[model samples]
Target: MKIKNRTLLLPLAAVLCVAALTGCTRTSYAIQTNDARTIISDGKPKEADSGLLEYTDANGVKQQISKTEVKQVTELPK
Candidate 1:
């Protein structure tokens, strides 16, 4: 009984560790606009409560752009 429990615990611990590490990882994204502008953000861009796509740029600047101005949003590979 003890050996069986230990074997199960090892895999469980490994899975939990993997999940925790991945959870901490964030994906960057490239936001393109109709005006030929590109913005890189740390995470996925989301619409603000005020109806604007708000995110922090790679330059560490806070930006709030309207949805009408955006052409597309693409996730950048790690």
Candidate 2:
């Protein structure tokens, strides 16, 4: 009886471990607005499916970064 229980529990434990590892990873992104406002964009923003932040530097060059890949974000004084 104990042997049969162990056999059943082993498979269930493996499935639970796999499910936890493959679960969606949540991330946060800092968006620098056009008006110099900073915001955190987690979900898909209007037009972008990846919830990426868009901004232009002093040179007027556009740049974008996805929320998922952003480990951390910091703002510097202009």
Candidate 3:
């Protein structure tokens, strides 16, 4: 019974370790508006044009905004 419990615990411990390591990775971005409000997005933004920017949100949907509406763009820490 002791040997059986040890075998199960070893695999469980490995899985938990992997999950914890992966959970620490989260990429976020910030878009500052002209009004001083910041929008936290899921990923980086793509340059659509001289006056337009595009990016995906946390819900996996694509979105676009005008560059004139943004004051600044930056990446958040992981």
Candidate 4:
């Protein structure tokens, strides 16, 4: 019983470690709008409660833009 438990624990621990580290990787994104303004986001944008598109800027600041203004969203190069 002890050996079986120990065997399972190693793989379980490894999986948990991998999952923990996975969240550390952040992908930046670029939001192209109808206007000439270029928006760089720290991560994927989300729809806020006010119905505006909310995203974290490259400077770590939170910003919101109207949905109508967004032309396209593309993942930036890593």
lDDT of candidate 3 at residue 5, scale 0 to 100: 98
Q: In model 1, which runs have C-alpha deviations exceeding 4 angstroms?
A: 1-23
Least lDDT summed over 10 consecutive residues: which range in candidate 1?
55-64
lDDT of 3 by residue, 8-65 (tens): 9989999999999998766889999999888777778888856788888778788888
Task: Report the number of the highest-TM-score candidate.
Answer: 4
**Which is better, 2 or 3, measured by TM-score?**
3
Estimate candidate 1's alpha-carbon lDDT, on a 0 to 1 scale. Answer: 0.91
The whole-model lDDT of each prediction reads 0.91, 0.57, 0.86, 0.92
lDDT of each residue in 3-45, candidate 2, tens digit only: 9999999999999998997675434445554555665544333
Error of 1 at 72 (Å): 0.2
Name model 3 segments beyond 4 Å from true.
1-26
**Cα distance off (Å), candidate 1, residue 62:** 2.7
Candidate 3 TM-score versus the reference? 0.64
Q: What is the TM-score of each candidate against the true structure?
A: 0.64, 0.33, 0.64, 0.65
Model 4 pairs in collision: none
Q: Per-residue alpha-carbon lDDT of model 4 for 1-78, expressed as tens digits?
A: 999999999999999999999989899998999996789999999987776899999899999999889998889888
Candidate 1, clashing residue pairs? none
Best by lDDT: 4
Using lDDT as the measure, name the better of candidate 1 and candidate 2: 1
